[model samples]
Target: MIRFVFAALLSVAAATAQAEVDIQEVTSPGGINAWLVEDHEIPFLALEIRIEGGASLDLAGKRGAANLMTGLLEEGSGEMDARAFQTAREGLAASFGFDNYDDSFSVSARVLTENRDEALALLRAALIDPTFDDDAVERVRAQVLSIIASDEKNPNRIAGAAFDAAAFGDHPYGSSLNGTAESVAALTRDDLITAHRNVLTRDRVYVGAVGDITAQELGVVLDDLLGDLPQSDAPLPEDVPFGLAGGVTVVPFETPQSVAYFGHQGLKRDDEDFFAAYILNTILGGGSFESRLMTEVREKRGLTYGVYTYLVPKDHAEMVIGSVASGNDRIGEAIAVIRDEWARIASDGVTADELSAAKTYLTGAYPLRFDGNAPIADILVGMQMTGLPPDYVINRNDYVNAVTLDEINRVAGELLRPDDLHFVVVGQPAGVENTN
Candidate 1:
């Protein structure tokens, strides 16, 4: 009853916040396409740009080159040195950020209407003519090396790295985005230049803009900003063969609590039954306090402080992963409970009441994501990159609501692999031995 009331209140809040958001697909004179949501009410504009094939496109020998190159983008560009570039940005009172992830390189910028053109020019310079100065390369390389060193002693990182290696084998996805200390130390300025050119190309780019910009003006901005990037000739990574064999692989570490990373193969984002599988996951573990995993492992038995699961639908691979940390003595019990819950959900599915509650929370919480212009712009670019239709923003909640119990159960039975679940435990946990 309490769950139902919370869901009802959230549904009301979502309905109240639902305003008509008009998205226009604009094509620039130079043939660049972008999604735009114009709101003249705000004096600021937020722009988001994504280039697919991010760090995954790094050269075979240089694992961290793409990541290093992304950091250097703002260090210096064209004629402006690092200090001069920053001074110019501060003068305009604008913000720009560049980031490299496993599958994409993203640029986010926010600027007042009066300084939009200047911000765009600065962004263009960074993208087109990055200096990759010798000093900047060494400086950023040291920072990355520091992080890699720190990750070596982090149990969670250790477990994740081991899990990826076991699941992906020789695939590039198995490798860390930051690369090893030796690999990063060996990176050169020329490598950074090549990585920059290979990853940030016109063919792989997607753009989304929101705020006080018209379609005509946005089209002009798109062309002026990205028209000159080299056409992408870089080959994308191949699909990873799913090879996550079941059983625990324990890395002995001295800690009071054992942290475990566990999962099995998962469905792709474009699968017809994705919505059903999504809701099934919610009832099982995606929901926080109300989820079966949390309720069983944390609320009832207190085996762990928290436990959760999520789906990772990458461009080249898909996975359903989860994690939990518990006292060494009780970690085994927690793992058993998680596995039991997985099997039960697969066989029995969720109840009608559970289904209704999942739908309410999922749909109601979605509208909260659109609270800001920058966030909306980010979502728009992500939608384009993922091949979602322009109306996805408006119809997404309907898709969640349309899921029925039958569909959810059928998907659960098809997708869950209790016997094939793999676990990587990182700590000295009693009764948990390495089975690799």
Candidate 2:
């Protein structure tokens, strides 16, 4: 019953947020900046923080330090042990999450306005004084190692790992942020501390706050929550151009089906033609059933259940990648069809009907993203990371709508590289030829 009420309220809030978002930029007394959206309809708030140079900040030979440190954040803090910390957070009905990605570390909080003070204090403790105690360290380390073990056996992971290794070389993006089993096992508590110091510094932080809070209140909240964090510029990974070329690298595994990951270089997020490329991809293989790859590979040939491509514009490098899974015997056909579509789109570009349909879908679907405070807060922080203006929430779909047919086709001509497409397949018993 309580859940139903909460869900209904969330639905209404989402509708309101979809209609309009008035984002205000706030600077705390301590000079920390944050983006805010106020909604006093409910006594709820969501705070999102992004610390740049996430796992990429892990020092030489300390590959998993940032990830390990992130995992240990909620495990314990200040004077409390892991269990005590969790109990206290639960008592205040607060939620805290910590995650590490290639370019940034994310911290999220959701709390009632009544408990905001208590919730934020606990969150601050987690950030400023995480206790990487022996017990917590071993526990989280074992969990990470277990994950590594599972990923090794997973065919999809195998294909992606091979794909990344081929594309990114020795850049941190080349390897799993989880690091190798050896690297993770060798990480000391001090390594985690160093990671915390390096990755969570104030110099590279981006913040977003949404729900029952004003700019003034959020200003105070920001200083209180993040002011004490060390102010140092963390070193970001150097940019490396996409290095993979067109070829097939087959890894032999005894399985009836093969999982393939493929792609080559991609454009940056700030590329002038990114919007055009986005729409073009939507018509090509943007995960929907309407995509050319899905229509050809699944409907016509019955080669795979799904095939899709995406633009991966990372902090340092960019990529246009796609994935598919099919019977080992038919994986060859899937790859051939995918490559043909790549060339077809690159050669002829999308039709006018396809462009119109893609624009409508893209524009129509944009508003549904603001489902609630947390999601909007997430979008706010993401915008900051990507250098988007606060008003982008209003004008984003306009950019997609503004892409002319000529513009997208021109991008297609320049962007899609059928000759340089790469495929990494994990499985045996196939008709596919190994090119590498």
Candidate number of the best TM-score? 2
Best by lDDT: 2
Every model's TM-score: 0.95, 0.97
Q: Give the C-alpha miss distance for residue 21 in model 1, angstroms.
A: 1.3
Using alpha carbons, what is the TM-score of model 2?
0.97
**In model 2, which runs have C-alpha deviations exceeding 4 angstroms?**
1-17
lDDT of 1 at 191: 88
lDDT of 1 by residue, 286-380 (tens): 95699999999999999988999998899999999999999999999999999999999999988999999999899878978886677788889
Predicted candidate 2 versus true structure: per-residue lDDT over 254-316, tens digit per residue: 888999999989999999999999999899999789999999999998999899899999989
Error of 1 at 15 (Å): 16
RMSD of each: 6.1, 1.6
